[model samples]
Target chain A: MLKIEGLRVELPGFALQDIHLEIANGDYFVLVGPSASGKTVLLETIAGMHRVSTGHIWLDQRDITGLEPERRQLGMVYQDCALFPHLSVAENIAFGLKVRGRPPSDIARQQERLVRLLDIGPLLARRTTRLSGGERQKVALARALMTDPEVLLLDEPLGALDPQTRENVREEIIKLHTELGLTIIHVTHDFEEAVAMGQNIAVIGAGAIRQVGPADEIFRHPDSEFVARFTMAVNVFPGRTEVGPAGTSTFVVADARLLTRSTVEGPCWAAIRPDSIQLVATSSEAGPDNRFTGQISRIINKGSVVEVTVDLPPAMTCLLTRHGFDQLDLAVGRPVCLVVPPAAVHLFQD
Target chain B: MSKHPGSQLRGKSRGGGQSLNWVFTLLGMLILLFILVPLFKMVFLSNKQALGQALLDPQTLSSIGLTIYAALIATAIGFVLGVPLAYLFARREFPGKGILEGLIDLPIVVPHSAAGIALLFVFGSNFLVGRGFKAVGIQFIDSLAGIVIAMLFVSVPILITSAKESFRKVDVRLEKVARTLGASPWQAFARVTFPLAWRSILAGSLMMWARGMSEFGAVIILAYHPTVAPILVYQRFETYGLAQAIPVAAIMIMISALVFIGVQTLLRRRDAGA
Candidate 1:
């Protein structure tokens, strides 16, 4: 288990304040945030590169806050794959073992294991400067894991690859995690990647973690406006909530009102995912509950799904499957009615 | 189509370009000749029989040997002290770092004779450092140690500046990665940083060694006895005139050029193999 309590690090023009986190052994956790959000700093601090201004870090019930990186027994792979250019791929992988003064036979055994596991057997004799981006990433991963560190910290590991290569490396990481039962902490700014690979995630913004929960919980229900916006929740509005008839909740934004099933009262913010709003023809006999009439302002084909922008009192974006869009024959400037179920709306107290 | 616009422009511009190219070629040849003419004249003017006799002379051989040996020792000393200081300056940022870097290059700009005079005051027989060394049974004046000290004082800045450039080219992230992968700070530097920067450091050592071999002003002031090749050449010129001095100078020049070319070729071949 790894635990960080009240960790604070101060760098130039950036600071991480009072960060608290806990990860169980063998869990795949991701730290997600926007650019320059201090994600990389936090990872480096955990790897013992940066000293904490305040707080303690505990690894496996031992306080390792003061240990050097070598003594901490943690491995880190940088975003740029900082491999030693002068060494061949085999030498690069064998570096850690050689530095630790392991016997030659033991070093060779571990090197062979990693080379086979990462499928880099053919690249062992090649120089590091000649490897492609994806090849370098594999070599870096092999080098990091050769030491059998307790926790492997990866900083944007797949952020530099093309789309097809990204998918391949992502699957490779997941396979390695399960096969080796390794505890991994991956950091990235892409939410889809987090949802795909992480069992639990911590959403960081402006140098602070706003929420930490399971992947589905973080995606479906965010705790703040900032978290909602960062997670691609398109329709978020600040409103005041009042108890309504039939045990429902009424949220009022400037001239618009939305009904929700949430029992929270007083001023609040409400958010709904773009895919949750359904669009129907204006003449459809939909119920009056949570229904609004609007004109379609724009329609965009987004490969797998079509995005339709509706101009209600406040503009809203809705996502539809290509088949659904073709069935409706949607076009710009067409009149439409939006159906938002009460259960789909999430309300958070301001 | 009959008169292509691109073809016409190329034809008109080609004539003007040829004259401009000729002017640059003439200027380049002038600079080249200026360097080569003196060397050719010296080699051709010296009588071959006299040059061979000078090469076989005992005094001449010992003087040339002492000069090369002292310069080699100076280069070794420079490498031992300058490499670590260069690495430190490249990796750390502290108050007055820029001023300290400028101070390292000061010896290069100072006049060599004036530099020898400054060293005389500090390491002369009567000075504190000189007395301290004398207590340990080592003398500097009129000794090989004095010649080496003079050469090192003037030539070490080249090594430091060149090593610093090589260290700067190495990425700090590579060292960090090594540290995280179970290597200590020293291990990372020895295995990664030093190997990556070795070529530049070797080139710098060559420059310092060559510069030390050619030093005359400082070595002459510090240690005039146990004459080096340059001092012997000066003495011959004064006593026997240009005829004797010409042959000795030509022999010295040939030896230095041969050594320089041989070492450079070995380094280039090693680089290609690596």
Candidate 2:
């Protein structure tokens, strides 16, 4: 297991607040945040690149916060791959062993294994500059893995590739992680990438982690307003919550009332994921549940999903599949009923 | 109907820009002629008898040899000491960094005679550094040591500036990757950074050596006995007439042209191959 406690790093005009995280052995954890949210800084710090102000990092029960990057035994792959241009692919892959003074036989053995594993046998003699993006990424991965580090840190490894190459390299990295069972910490800013690759996700905002859980939990039940907005839970309303006589609660905004399962009171923010809300015809909207009658203010086609904006005194956005959108024959200025389940309305204090 | 303002301006610029290209070419050709005419005349005007005599004279040949040798030594010393300092300037920021960088360019702007006097203050026989060296039976005044000191003082800035630019061109992330791959700091530099930047460093060294070989005022100030090629040409012009000086000047010109062409061809071929 790798653990970080009270991690704080200060840079000019930016600082990472006290951060604590734990990754179990052989687990795939993804740190997701927007640009300059301190994701790369935290990864570099864990790799022993930056100086820690007040922190303790333990890897497999050994204190390694003060160790050098080479002594820390962590593999790192950057977005650009950063393959040494001076060395050919074969020499680049063997650099770690060569620097360590390992025997030629041992170096050749490991080199052959990685070459076969990554299917880069033909590229061994080629220069790094001649390889394509996917080829370069694979070679960088093989080079990092040659050292057999205890943990692998990938800093947006697929951020620089084209769409098709990104997909191919993404699968290649997943295969490597599964085959080797290496503890991996991947950092990225793409939401779909985080959901697709990470077994556990951590959402960071403004240099502090806002939420950490399974992908579904973070998507459906964000713990803070920042997490909700970052995760694209678009229908968040600032309101005051009043506990009802029963177990449910009523969140009152300017002119709309939202029923939520949360029992918390006082001023708070209520988030309802766009995908969780359903659109029904206004004529049959007779149910007494959480339903609001509103006019469709805008219809935006976002490729696979359609974003429908409605004004129920307060404008709300809802997401629907293309099939559902086509079936509903929805259009701008049309009246519709929005059904938001009480369980879907997550409330959190400021 | 009036034309759109943006389209009218674009049309005017397009026509004017093409005519301006011809004017630029004319001005550029004038400067090229100004530089090449004198050099070409000097090389082509020398008679065969004087040229043969200049090559046969031991004094002229030895001065050329000594100039080349001292420049080589000074360039070697600069490479050993200046590369690390260049890397530091390229990669790190500390107190007085801006001033240090400005100071590296000092030798370039200062007059060669003034620079010679400044070196005399610090490295003269009575100064601290010169006295310490004299204790080891080494002297700088009117000797090969003094020639090398003058050459190095005037030429090292070229080397450091070029090397620093080369280091800046190399991505620092490459070294970071090497460190994560189990290489120490020094090993990362040797295996990664040095190889990437060595081409530019060599190009810079060639320039520094060429500049040092042609230095006149500084070397004359420190050592006039073991003469360099430029000083020999001057002495020939002063004692004899311009006729005697042309042969030695032509020989130095030939050597400079050969070295310059060789370095340029080498750099071009390497770039093409890479």
Candidate 3:
């Protein structure tokens, strides 16, 4: 496990205020945020690139904060796949293992396993400059894993790949992570990538993480408006909260009302995942369980899904599937009910 | 207007006629003529008899031989020392990097005669360095070694500059990767960076050697007795007039140009093969 504490950085206006996190062995932890959110900076710091102003990093219980990147037994893959162009693919793949002073036979054994795992056997003898993006990324991953590092830090390893190639290489990275059971702290601005790739996602903002939880939970239960917006939580409705059951609160959306399971209220904000909202026609609008009424504002065709933006009362939008939109067959000016099940409602303190 | 697409495209480049292009072609010819005229005069005027007579004279032949030998020695010394300095300038950052690089380049801006006067102050037989060296049986004043030192003093900056540019073009990631691959810093540099920059270094060395060979003022002031080819050419003109000087100048230019073209061709062929 790797742990970081008090990762405070004094930037011009913001500080990375006391960042504390832990990654257990075999954990695929991802740092997700938009550009300039300090995700890359934090990852690079963890990778032994930048000097932490005030912090201690522990790798498997050893204080490695002062160790050089090469000595830390940590492997890093950059977005650009910084492969040594002067070396052949075989030599590149064997780089870290050689650095560890392994015997020739032992190096060969590790090289063979990586070659098969990444399926780069034939391309091993070729110069690195000739490798395509996917091919180069594969070699870079293999090289990183050759040392059998305690943890692998990937800085948007697929940032340079095409869509299809990104999917393939991402799968390769995950498969290696599974096979080696390596600890990972990957960073990316790609929302779907984070969801698909990481088990535990930290929603970072400005320079600090607003919330850290299981990817699905953070998506369903964001703790702040910043986290809400960053996680692609599309429907943010400003509202006022009133005290209710035990610690629970009732939120008053504009021209509409909804109740969350938690209550800390003055001026409160509520977010609903687009997929969390169920669209129903006027006949089914008679239910009273957290419902809003509005017209089908627009229909946007998202591949295999249609994004339905509804100007419902209380004013909100949600993403429903093409099949869901097709069967509803509701046109503009057509009235419908927006249903956000209370369990799916994420509440944030004002 | 005819709607032929290709013809309209051609018309835009040439205004549908060749008049403007002809002017451009003539302008290019004039530019070439401006450069080639001086080069043409420098060659083709030297004759075998005059050159033979110059080479036969002991003073003239000895000076030409010493000039060639000293330039070679100085170029060799620069190759050994300048390459590392070039690499350091290109790769490493330190305090006073700009000033150090500028100081290395100072010789290029200083006049050759001024360079001779400066060297005389430091390495003269009566000066501290020259006196110390003389005590050790090594003398700088009026010696072939002094001429070689003067040549190196003046021309090494060019070698360092060209070599630094070459080393900069080489991706530093290659060195980093080599280090991660278990090669030591020296091994990585020797195995990779040196080979890649070798061509540029070679080209730079040739240019420096050519420059050093043509040096007159500094060598003449420091060690005029062991006259180099340029000084010999000068001495011949003083005693026997331009008739003697022109042939030696032509012969020196011929030999230097041949060497320059040969090395350049080799560089081009290697690049093309790669």
Candidate 4:
């Protein structure tokens, strides 16, 4: 288990403050945030690359806050795959073992294991400069794993690859983690990647973690407006909430009222995911709690799904499958009814 | 179709660009000729009999040997002392770093005789550093030590500047990754950073050695008794005029050119292999 308590790192113009997290052994934890949002800094700090101002990092019940990176036994793969350009692939993978002065036979054994694990045998004789982006990532991963580090930190590992290559490598990395059952902390700004890879996610913004929970919980119930928006909750509105007669909640923004389950009754921001709002023709039967009739103002075909914008006083975006969009024959300037469930609107204090 | 607008414009531009290229080629050839003419003429002026006699002359041979010996020592010293400073200049920033870097390059800009005078202040027999070394029975005046100190003082900046550039080209992230992968700081530098930068460092050292070999003014002031090749060339010119000096000058030029070409060819082959 790895635990960070009250971790504070002060950089030149930014500071990550009071970071607290506990990652269980064998758990795949992800840190997700926007660019320059301290995600990489936090990962580097965990890897013992940065100086921690006020904190204690406990690994398996031992305080390792003052340990050097080598002693900390944390492997880190950089976004650019910082492979040693002068070394061939086999030498790069065996670098850690060689530096530790392992016996030749032992080193060879470990090298064989990692080469087969990463399926990089064919690339063993090639220099790192000859590898493509995806190939470089694999070599970097093999090199990082050579030391048998307790936690592997990946900083935007798939961020440099093309879309198709990224998917392939992403699957490979997931398989590597599962097969080894190693604890990993992967950092990226892609929410879909976080949801796909992480069992638990920490949403970092500015310099602090806004929320940390299971992937679905953080996605469904973000603690702040920043978390909500960063998680691609595209429909957000500043509003006030009032307790209804039956202890229900109603959020008011501009001229539209949204039914919500939140109990806090004051100025707030109501966030709704684009996929959660359902658009139906006016002739269809609609529920009463959160039904608004609006004209379709925009239509965008996004390969798999279509994004439709509805002008209901405050504009709203809804995602629909291509088949659903074709069934409705949706077009701009057509009237549509938007159905939003009360449970779908997440409201938080401003 | 006969006169497509874009094709006509492209033809005109291409014709203009070709003329500009010819002008640039002519100017480049002129400078190349200016450098090659004197060197080639000096070699051709000396007959093989005179060149063989100069090669067999004890003084000429010993002086050439001393020049190579002193330059080698100076380059070795520069590698030992300047490489660490180069690494620091490449990686770290501290107060007065700019001033220190400027001080490293000061020898290059200062007049060589003036630099000899500056060294004499600190390293002359009666001075503090000289006195300290004298306690150990090592004299700097009119000694091999003096010759090497002068050459190193003048030529080490080339080594340090190029070494600093080499170290700066290596990504610091590679070193960080090495450290994380069970290597200590020194091990990381030795295994990763040094290997990556060594080729450039070798190239820099060769340039420094060449510069040290050609150094004359500082060595003349400090150790004229133990003559290097350059001082010998000057001395022959002074006593026996240009006729006698030309043979020794031609021999030195041939040796220097041969060494330069050999090192360049070796480096090019290594680059291609890599």
Among these predicted structures, which one has the highest TM-score?
A: 2
Cα error, candidate 1, residue A151 (Å): 0.6
Residue pairs in collision within model 3: none
TM-score of 1: 0.88
TM-score for each candidate, following the candidate numbering: 0.88, 0.96, 0.82, 0.95
Top candidate (DockQ): 2
**What is each predicted model's overall lDDT from 0 to 1?**
0.89, 0.90, 0.81, 0.90
Interface RMSD, model 4, angstroms: 0.6
TM for candidate 3 is 0.82
CA RMSD per model (angstroms): 3.5, 2.2, 4.3, 2.2
- Sorted by lDDT, highest first, which candidate order results? 4, 2, 1, 3
Cα lDDT, model 4, residue A251: 92
lDDT of 2 by residue, A111-224 (tens): 999999999999999999899999999999999999998999999999999999999999999999999998999999997899899988999888888888887788878878
* TM-score (C-alpha) between model 4 and the true structure: 0.95
lDDT of 4 by residue, B58-132 (tens): 999999999999999999999999999999999987899999999999999999999888888888988999999
lDDT tens digits, residue span B1-274, model 1: 5469988888879988999999999999999999878777788877989988988999998998998999999999999999999998999878899999999999888999888888888788899998888789877788998899988999999999989998998998899899998889999899999988888788788888878877888888889978888889999999999888888788777776776686587568546745
Error of 2 at A37 (Å): 1.2
- Which segments of candidate 2 are over 4 A away from where they belong? A283-287, B1-14, B269-273
Q: In candidate 1, what are the lDDT values of residues A1-350, reduced to their tens digit?
A: 99999999987789999999999889999999999998999999999988799998999998988899989888899888999989999999999999999999999999999988999999999999899988998999999999999999999999999998888889888988999899999999999899899999999988888899999998988889988998888899888897866677887776567888877799888888989999997555435487877789988899989999888767878999999998998889898989888887899964
Name the lDDT of candidate 4.
0.90
TM-score of chain A of each: 0.97, 0.96, 0.92, 0.96
